[model samples]
Target chain A: MKRNPIGVLLALIAALALLASACGSDDGADSADEVDSGDTAESTSAESSASAGPLRVGIVAPSASNDLAFTQSIVDAVNAVAGDRELDIAVTDGTFIVEDAAAAIRGYAADGVDLVIAHGSQYGGPLQEIAPDFPDTAFAWGTAVDTFGLPNVAAYTVRADQGGYVNGTLAAQLSESGVLGVVGPIEVGDAKLYVDGFVAGAKAQDPNVTVNVNYIESFSDVALASEAATAHIQNGADVLTGTAQMVVGATGVAGPAGALWFGTQSNQTPLGPDFVVASQVYHWEVVLSEMMAEIDAGTFGGEVYTLTLENGGLVIEFNDGAGADSSVIDGAQATIDGIIDGSITTSDG
Target chain B: MWSDFFTTSVIVATLASAVRFATPFLLAALGEAVGQRSGVLNLGVEGVMLCGAFTAYYVRLNPSGWGWAGGMATAILAALAVGLCMGLLYAWMTLVMHAEQGISGIGIFLFGLGATDLLFQKQVGVPLPISGLRPIRIPLLGDIPHVGDILFNHNVLVYLAYVLVPVITLMVNRTTFGLNIRAVGETPEAADTLGVNVNLIRLGAILIGNALAALAGAALVMNTNIFQQNLTAGQGFIAVALVYFGAWRPGGVMAGALLFGLVSSTVLQLKTLGIVSGAASALTAMAPALLTIVVLVIVSRRIGQPSALTRPFDRNA
Candidate 1:
């Protein structure tokens, strides 16, 4: 009876993995926990500028922290706000299920964190049910303006259309084919706002430019998104934009096709530096900082915060490397200024 | 308006997308056709695809600083390894444990969904892009106009998928193993009487089915040049349908896959040209599923299903 060499090799590798874990220190184990991210793993990192006085925070999101879409927007904002401050951050991401998010939110509250951001609109129902149970713990949820009449809950909403207009203005001028396309997830919610605003802005810039919009009616159907982008490209659309996470698939198609892409929810420059013209980045730090100040002043909630360009909650992140002409950049800034000063209005549906 | 919508460029683009869309379905369904012919109703094809897709993408992400060939080889091997492991587990559950096939299959799907998503978040942490297998144009043939662009300009996986149709057809219809498979599927008792190893044949079929399902995932991830949770996004379940509607015949499965791709791409083209809009567009999204159901219902009645599908084999009984 001959023992297989491959089996022997597998057993040896398993033994080594166990040995490595056994040899690691408590701090190493703690750091490993931070990287062990997901729905179940509450990545609690103990490091802070100050050991005892750092602001304690926890995040419960519906998707991965690095989704480069909705969740990434809040996570990046929180990181920016916590900069140079002794802040302790823990993330329990990929809680797409409502029940899972509710549990994580309660868990963060039970752990007595100073701030717990429940980062999904779907989680709104659960937070409404859970917030009363832990009144002292500050909790926030978004894409909605209602704070559930709860004193301790903070509600944040984004004027994605604000940045959508800026993106639209630039795309209309930049498109060589006089055509633009938008692949929206659904015909409602924040995605609708962005798409509608984009079409409006494109029309405002050039009335003759054909702006096509396709609401595929799904948030995660990547294949359909790809097909929609391809369809738009075939129809002479040189500019493309889509909302929701599934646009990851559309970006892949658009990049190879040399189509200019305008992004929203988060900065998507990293997806394709050469083609992603700009992103309507949500800077939640504007609201989060104000919330922190209110918390320090012994005020917990009772306010609905809207992320507006006027308040610096939304920013049009232009990729200088993508090389838009100075006139286009200047035109974009002028549009932003007009919107901020009430000279321009994003027609809301 | 009609003339604008029926342009040559638009038709060519739609056909090309149909080919790309059909590649994964064709791969998974062909393997599924083989297994179904042997009477194994393994509905865990989608789950196995996720494991394969994730493994292939993760391996290719870093590339181990290897050259193009080395990186591609490594990624493909990793995907195959994951597929083989998933197949063995599924085979054990249905064969050794004699678990209810449909329920166990669903269990596999759910596990793949949760596990792959969790593993991705834990391991990758971010959606980092990878340049997967690139398209290799077929020299002089690729220089031909519309036909060549639509047919000869796809990646190697697309070529492999089309090539395997006849190979699978022959294996299922021409060989001694094929005879044994048909006997077991139709009448296991008679196959046993004839000294056929029913379980071994079934196991071999299951392995081939799952490995091909995995390859379908790899093809998808490679073509997309990216990975996401549930990246296959119901394509696996659709692949399983392709097998059933295709009547356990490789050629039929290929036709079913192509039909689905064509319907989907054509509707997209219509929507883009503004021929479909408002309520019509919403309804158009359901066109592919409706067509698939219609075809499956009509085709299945005409060709019929396997005699012993989803039936567990026990020689003593």
Candidate 2:
């Protein structure tokens, strides 16, 4: 049967639009909700008070809460910071779509949460728009410095390089091939900062060591990340370090090849015990707790919080399962102390 | 750094990576070629791939009581079944319901991506590792140094993808079914008048195409033993593009897949060897797609697409 081409095309477009809307954001929330610490509608008294009651905190992240990459870093930190202070935490993760994330941010702010952490750089713009409407609620977003200069918004940025440098220094020691590899997502924001710092520290540790870096240009292309790591291994790279969630792919290849893996953003020890020597864990709690304290002291958001080694915001967590020698641990600690003090200098780029 | 990239070892490693990379593309693009040959455009190849990859990974994560072989077989079958179901849906939309092929295919892709992500979240809350298939060394052939590693040291599915190219070529070129498909795709009115079932041929082609695409997704997830949302990435769409780049021939499709694989691998290798950096590496990464687009431009004028592609054929009309 010959159908009218134009009519069929119009009908398909209409059906697709409806289907697309139905399938898109609702699934994003359902997936993220599974990873949430608290049910979406559970504990809410329109007054978010950190001093008098448990601090009500809500998080909107771009990927899964346990992605073991960017999103996990903040989620882990928030959970950690809940110590001593009873914190009511809710998370809407896997909101990689900016618009969906924006909606989630607005919802949290409207709920009168004490702090709404938009845990993605892309959410910066959305936070900017949503913060002014909820002037009483403090909004924090990052790996970015921009707070839109809003009185009700705070910014948190990480010196991921502080940890990346330490990771690279350790990588240089663990590598027998003297050739290290990096599987990067995209060379922008924290990913780039981490890679640059890794290279600087590795080159500083062993000037002749070769660190081959491959930016697969995608954060979730696990297959490509695997191939990149394979290429590195095939070419004699015995130590691999990478950023972003896709490093799970790299870690998978590294374990079987007997190559040591160094991680960042979150403690990737759970990725595998065999390959993960150490990780540069982002302890956002240090910065976050400070922000919460400031808010409790009647200061709304006029400051930028930076996570640094000195501030105890970022720490090199040695995977005891990998079982590194004392010398390796001592060297990493020394590098950390140096970066913390004035001795060790890192490339900020 | 430049000298390191030019070494024979690096070259061999790059080629090996390229071959591994090409496996998924070949599986998907070859299936797409078959579907296009039958005058149907299944743009949802990517979506089907996502569903397939997730199904395979989820199944692989939960090992059945029947050991490694059984678990592996079950996962593969499950993924293939999902593909078949998706294909049936695509066929029903285009063939029975007479929906516009392009738009409906996209809808399928979006649905697959979203649905798999939802299933993954509900079934497996976090990304966990599984024991994926390991590379098998062919008896004597695997003993050869670099050449053996490149060709013989591959998983079963990798070998299957390469083997299917010729089998499909033979089926499409030599069989009566192939002839009927070509006739229906090219001259559906005459084929229908002569008692050929156009819809049946198209349906078969779509089902076969979708199954292969699903296998491609399965191969990707099995390689890593890890499943995330959109694990197949944009490989499905790339496979569709490769069909056109190959002028809809299975041989040409294989070449296109291999070419893309090599270029991508080579670019990655260059960066890995420290011979390329920064924006230059980014630009070089686009080589495969650029090369494909150039071929497409040349083929558009010289070659022919299936005459009745995307058009719903009605016997009454």
Candidate 3:
């Protein structure tokens, strides 16, 4: 077959066009009144000058909202907060490409959602752009580092590293190979920080611990994650931990091999019986509870909240099962309690 | 990494991987064989396979906690029904509406992906588990050296995959339906003039192809207890590629599937042994695909595709 130069050129042009579209952020702006119909349950009591209609909450997920771990937690949190009050919560899923996120935020703002919460760290830039457009609506985003808080948007998160550190300690003690493995979606700041914490925590538990870290480069590739775990296992890494949303593939590979596996987000003990040793779980209830309490107390505004062991934002659950038993759970619990009691402090302090 | 190859565990891992990889391809190919023999070229195999995988997982993982065997059966039947419906739909669209065959096949794929993803989100949330198929060791054969571990001690699907190859080969190369299918695919007008119910044969092919795709999906979920969103990961495409490798013959497809299985198993073995260093691991993972592309290039010259491949039959033509 003779290769067609024009066809190749057209294909290139099409690819370039797609890349350009995928690269740009959404710039469309929408007015608040156009979207929110006043019928949602409004607690007339929330401090942010309760509007005639119920609260309008918007959530933007850089990844799929169906992600049962991270994004799902935030969705559950919004649902919990909306459960009591007059609230209409709208969510846009699968916003990995930067521009789609901007469009989602603008659309939510136009809909007159009172509070806009962007779950992924990558949404920080777009959230900042749209927060100014909808000043009346409060904004809370989950960011790894210091939040560049805008007047309307506030960054809120916990010390994920702190919890990772505790879990790392557990993994180190359980690892027979002294080679521990960590699988994450991408090497972003948020994930990097977690890995750093895990390495530190592992070393703290046992000075000689060696940790191997690999990133799947995408959140959606479970097969890649499974292969990575198998490679790590083959390398004599007895314990495996992942920061991905669903640890099914990773756990599947690790469990059958009789290696220790740890999960992130929710307690995944149900995934593989006696496989997961510990999980760095985020208690969305704590964040939602605090937000609800503040809103009810008539004190809603842009405020960045950090939920750590001190405030119970994040906690580590060391698997108490006999087969996946770890003494490090006790040690980590003690450190957590000590931190809460002001006796122990991480570098963040 | 090479050390892993010599170890006892590596042998088990490779054996497991081969069985795992072969299950879906075997099922899909078996279905394709039925369709091809009936004189139809059903390109909607990928879509049907995905639908089967999703449906089977949902049935198995639903609150009842149906065992893996039940899940496989459900998946197989569901896929078969879907295949039957899709086959009828394709026949109606192509035979009645006279739409382009390639276009209709693409439409089927899009419909399957969207419908499955949406239904999965609404129904049985992600990460559904079926009582997975456990390995059963055959008495004397399972006790043999390295080969026994490779061939025996497989889940029911593995054995089925192995047994179905020859059964399908015999059924097609040796049966009346097989001749009818080949004739239909080659010269539809001639078959029609010969008093064959052209529509019936084509519809049967479509239904059978779809069911086989579904069984492929079932094998996938049964092997991996947990089902994630879009778990097939282009294995449907891989199965189609296998058809080309087998030169569209049952025996050829089976051999190609086993070859791909071995390639996959070898990669996993290398990873386990830490023999694949640094950037090589990524290459190792792609080994199966690369091997497939290479084999296809070499084999395409020897094997001729169906005369009416991808072409919807026209009464005038």
User: Candidate 2 — which residues are off by over 4 angstroms?
Assistant: A1-56, A82-90, A103-114, A125-134, B64-70, B143-145
- Which scores higher on DockQ, 1 or 2? 2
TM-score per candidate for chain A alone:
0.85, 0.86, 0.77
Candidate 1: tens digits of C-alpha lDDT, residues B160-268: 9999999988887899998888888888778988999988898888888888988998988888777888788899999999987888889989999999999988888
What TM-score goes with each of the models?
0.86, 0.91, 0.76
**Highest TM-score model number:** 2
Question: Comparing 1 and 3 by lDDT, which wins?
Answer: 1
* Per-residue lDDT over B1-317 for candidate 2, one digit per residue giving the tens place of the 0 to 100 score: 67877888888888878888999899999999999988898888999999899988888887864466448888999899999999998888889878888988888888887788767766785677777889999999988988998889989999999999899999999999999888888989999989999899999999999999999999998787788877887899999989988888888988889989999999888877767878887888778889888888988889889998878888987
DockQ of each: 0.27, 0.51, 0.09
DockQ agreement of candidate 1 with the native complex: 0.27
lDDT of 2 by residue, A162-272 (tens): 888988888898788899999998888888989999999999999999988889877887888888899888988999999998888888788877888899998888777
lDDT of all the models against the reference?
Answer: 0.81, 0.84, 0.66
Q: In candidate 1, list every pair of residues with a backbone clash.
A: none
Which consecutive 10 residues in model 3 chain A have the weakest lDDT in total? A25-34
